[model samples]
Target: MQVFPYSIVAIFFIHHAVGLSFGSIFNDLKDTFSYYSSSLISEQCDKRWIPENITGLEDDLEKYLHGQDLAAEIIISALRSHLKKTYRKKPLVFTLHGWMGGGKGYTADFILKNWFLKGGRSKFVRKYFARKGYTADFILKNWFLKGGRSKFVRKYFARK
Candidate 1:
């Protein structure tokens, strides 16, 4: 028998109509010793999430984020009207700019959790950490070569 080592395990919540919630764990095993470069890891199909869970989300954002009411409101409004037919035509882009320890990351996390169906684990979301050891060239190379932008755009947003 072949032994497979699990490298990535992702859990997703499936809400059923019967008011029962279940968790799904997807275990993906890959061969790390191979000479191949940039092998496929874990990927989730992109899906839209309704922003009907706004009340709880607003409360959480208010509690966790201080002096960021305007930012929180903007994010929430964008999410709420993202799926509506009477919204803007272009894709919405949110930029959270701040110095270190200025709660930018925290606010971004809050937005992701509330706006996305699966929180930070949503397939529609992609996070890039701009820390030391990761330069623009390296980031672009990974984004292009590792099938990040092309594959995702083709698979998820190719239709509309």
Candidate 2:
């Protein structure tokens, strides 16, 4: 007669004791591994930057932003084209310039709400403004002149 190893004997007894066949045990392990691997992949990936609703964004831009039809259309088209790529060499940057009451900030806020999962409250999104004490001159002198744009560009647009 052939002698069975301790592990083989233990496995045999455990299999019978647990009412599970070798195939079932292997299948269970495979399922568990698959679940854990997928969870790990999701955790490691950063997908917050992807826009969630492009069509809704386009519609909202058109409906809410009065007298800015061309701007809305251009923004939607540019965003759609940029986001369709599998790999991006650089982040898409939009410079919204107009009169003080031209709804630039409103448009930005709207886009942010539609793009991010947490909308404007997302931790990945940062908003810098020239508030009460911080005037435009102060910001220009401190931030724009002192390589702040470079730092901002590196953090958001550059490859890690």
Top TM-score prediction, candidate number: 2
**How high is each candidate's TM-score?**
0.50, 0.55
Off by over 4 Å in 1: 1-52, 86-90, 131-139, 150-160
- For residues 51-121, write the lDDT of model 2, one tens digit per residue: 45788898789789999888898889888897788777786777776777788778877777777655666
For lDDT, the strongest prediction is: 2
Give a tens-digit lDDT track for model 1, residues 83-119. 4645454655676776778777777676666655666
What's the lDDT for all of these models? 0.54, 0.62
Instruction: Report, for all candidates in order, the number of backbone clashes.
Output: 0, 0
- What would the TM-score be for candidate 2 when compared with the true structure? 0.55
